[model samples]
Target: MNELLKVNYDSDRITLSARELHEFLGVKTKYKDWFPRMCEYGFSENVDYRLVAQKRATNNPKNPYTEFNDHEITLDMAKEIAMIQRSEKGKQIRQYFLELERKWNSPEAVMNRALEYSRKQVQALLQTNEKLELENKIKDQQLNELKPKADYYDQILQSKSLVLISQIAKDYGYGAPTMNKKLHELGVQYKQGGQWLLYSKYQNKGYTHSRTINITRSDGRSDVRMQTEWTQKGRLFLYELLRKNGILPIIEQN
Candidate 1:
């Protein structure tokens, strides 16, 4: 609003009138707070506030101007004054002003503009977060819907009725170890019971049913049975096995 002050937007520079500089440096006692505190550190007002040759010539010439405004102040002039006032006590104040000027004119302003752009991008992401979450939920529901049908096919292959490991190996056209590994991957369990029974399912003759087999242990001491029905004991045993192996998935209770 001051007539003698002009701000250049393209250069980001401010031109200050002599009167404004005098007022800012507190040449008058009314605005003492605006004065640089270096005035206390051997910074006599006479040395810091002086009239430049150009500023001396005014329309009146009789009353030579002794002050210059912020725009009239150059970077070199500010640095020179700061260097003269350099002392342990004034170091912080000097550095503060130096850094303030550096930030105002340096590439940091560009960085701040970039930071503002990134903040807007983050705001946009947050705005659509709910829609993204809803899409994820729909995908999860579709996965859940297809899960039972896949489980049905898996049950047919791992039927508990296929007692002997060799039988499952024969049906699946895989080796015993491969069959065992497949069953292990599918979380199939074998139970010791009245007879050697196989409980895995096999898709045969256009129908899927539990396959059963009767067999004796190699030692003749125990009979084993495999089944698809997951019992409380079976579940507990499976849970313990998985826990021991560190493969257990967390189960939520109703």
Candidate 2:
């Protein structure tokens, strides 16, 4: 806890630098020679301690960098090495390590660790909620952009009123007479004595409705005639028929 020998807490278990431990214990032998001998006393390689390669500047300038090996031994192994030294410094280090092990496993330390874990979980959940909210906002914007088209299509389907030929023709960028000529050319209608009528093939198809109208000419005489108007179904039929011929309404073209 007071930085006695720079212990490593990066791993799940506490580990000590074996070279540092040797120096602190005042071993007579050099680290390269002393560490191997310490391993000989029933200490396994990776289970008790692991080797770490490090680089440093050398005294000789010609070979400026040199690589050396150090070991990270567990607390249990360090304690064992300290006891084997049979010195006052070794006893003191061993006592310090024992205290560290006790505090590290205490209930207070465990509770602190649990609270830290819960804090991290809550932070992660908050970030996820922000992301979901952003996604929903984008989806709502997309639906809003499509709403006008949906409303227009619904109006077209629900209309029950009859439309004049001129009105349908205007939608297709055509005047009434031009539209009639085109329809006659397409074999859908024919010009009779006083009016345009659907061809025999298209007659009685519920595409048109005849309304009787009384007209007064410039001669002060009145006349009765049947005026043909297109129903919604007939308008839709003309839309499809004209669309196949590469014709489209102004609204559709826009």
Candidate 3:
């Protein structure tokens, strides 16, 4: 067998035997037909005979093989071969041959190295996915815990009691104007009589209801009566009343 036909069992460098190299280069002719042409063209006597023969056989017959084999392989030829072998479309073909060569002739260390690299990449991707899943679960749990309190606050704001609105705001830590702004958004209405009265449209159809609240002073001598009616200014006043009394709940807004 030719020296070029012998495989190196230790080298990691990609290599090809003379016959194999010829096949890779796509030479259609036989080695016997090509070796003499290389010699006639001044290929070195020391040149790998099989490689030279394959090259000669593959040369276009129209352009007879006159180029010297003794000439060093140019950088352009090396680049051309690399481009063809390493292209995206050629990845599978190159990897298949490379793995086969590694399995057959390379050391066990090389195979182990490749396997270790692949394992590390898989482990990293799994860890990242797990962390994202854990964060999403925590966010969902937090939302579940706060939803009921928020709903309760909404119900209170939508109720038809000025006293209750003020109490809720004070309990929940909302300022008067802020609480009133929220009430207005919910379409609740307020009216001023002796004091402020808040009402909901659904509770008092046709805006006619006599939901009255009376405030008695601490001296036990002064009494105040407030009647409910629907108006924007009344609602604002009711908000002020609730805020001044410190009755807004902090839970409703958040």
The candidate that wins on TM-score is 2
lDDT of 1 at 22: 40
TM-score of each: 0.21, 0.47, 0.34
Write the residue-wise lDDT of candidate 2 on 108-208 in tens digits: 97787677778888999999999999999999988876665465455557988887899888876889999999998888998776788998888888999
Per-residue lDDT tens digits for candidate 1, residues 88-158, read: 42354345446555666678786776777798889999879978999999999888865754553454445
Least accurate 10 contiguous residues by lDDT in model 3: 70-79
What RMSD, rounded to one decimal, does every model reach? 18.2, 9.9, 15.3
Whose lDDT is greatest here?
A: 2
Off by over 4 Å in 2: 59-62, 117-254
Query: How well is each residue in 111-148 modelled by candidate 3, as lDDT tens digits?
Result: 77677778888999899989999988999888876675
lDDT scores in order: 0.45, 0.86, 0.48
Q: Which parts of model 1 have CA positions greater than 4 angstroms off?
A: 1-112, 127-132, 160-254
User: 1 or 2, which is superior by TM-score?
Assistant: 2
Q: Which residue runs does candidate 3 get wrong by more than 4 Å?
A: 1-102, 105-114, 137-163, 172-187, 195-249, 252-254
Better of 2 and 3 by lDDT: 2
